[model samples]
Target: MADLKVGSGEDIIITSGLGSCVGVTLYNKSTKIGGMAHVMLPEFPANREQGNPAKYADTALDMLLDKLRKKRVNLNRLEAKMAGGAQMFNFSSSNDKMRIGARNIEAVERILQEKGIPILGAEVGENYGRTMELHNATGKVLIKTVKHDDIVL
Candidate 1:
């Protein structure tokens, strides 16, 4: 659901209920600072100017990076880990608009690439919901799902 957070040191940022939504973490291991975003859509709506930026993958990472920049986290030292983007609903037609999870994943990856942030690991695209946590102190991302063993990325 449209939420984002930034933390430092031993803080752990967590997000749950990630069905068809993406959870992304940007971490600077040297500084022990990181940010997490629960992105609900692929891109921000072009017609709207007054919406939560955290709701869209295209805008969420920028917001997160700005916050991290304010905290003096070096962009050059940052790495990424991501989880979620589950296809919770089944669509009979092969319409792209129905593939929200896939679109979110693509948007996030593209944005990160444009920013020159390398993704260290990811757990994405399945039929189940997920929860993700970013451990700021360790730059470790933990992905939790109901049907599978907990994953560390």
Candidate 2:
């Protein structure tokens, strides 16, 4: 599933159980408004499906950006960091959608570039899961994996 949260420096947004899902964060250093999205799917319908805005990469990014704008955060000052998007399940199928983890990473990166948000760091791709926390106060992303030491990006 996908979800989005936007908050100022006083807040810390967290997302967990990211197997083939990517946890992305966009942060504005000046305003200290951070936005995070737990993206499940790579894309959404062109017409915009009547579903959760945070349920897909396409819609989730848009919604998060809108929220950031509404909060008076300058887009030009924004940067992105991501974690998760692991290839959790192995499959013989070559279908792109089946490679959810990689697809999610690619889609998220593409969207962030389109929005002019530089990707400062990322912890993506592998055969594991991750939990991420975005600290709005310092623009730091804390990524925790079950079998590895904690990573800060």
Best by TM-score: 1
Q: Give all candidates' CA lDDT scores.
A: 0.92, 0.91
Per-residue alpha-carbon lDDT of candidate 1 for residues 18-69, written as tens digits (9 for 90 to 100): 9889999999988899999999999999999798988999889989999999
What lDDT score goes with residue 15 in model 2? 96
Candidate 1 residues lying further than 4 Å off, grouped into runs, are: none
If scored against the real structure, what TM-score would every candidate get?
A: 0.98, 0.95
Total backbone clashes of candidate 2, pairs 3 or more residues apart or in separate chains: 0
* Per-residue accuracy of model 2 over 43-136 as CA lDDT, tens digit each: 8867865877697898899999999999988889999999888998889989987888999999999998888899999999999999999999
**What's model 1's lDDT at 145?**
88
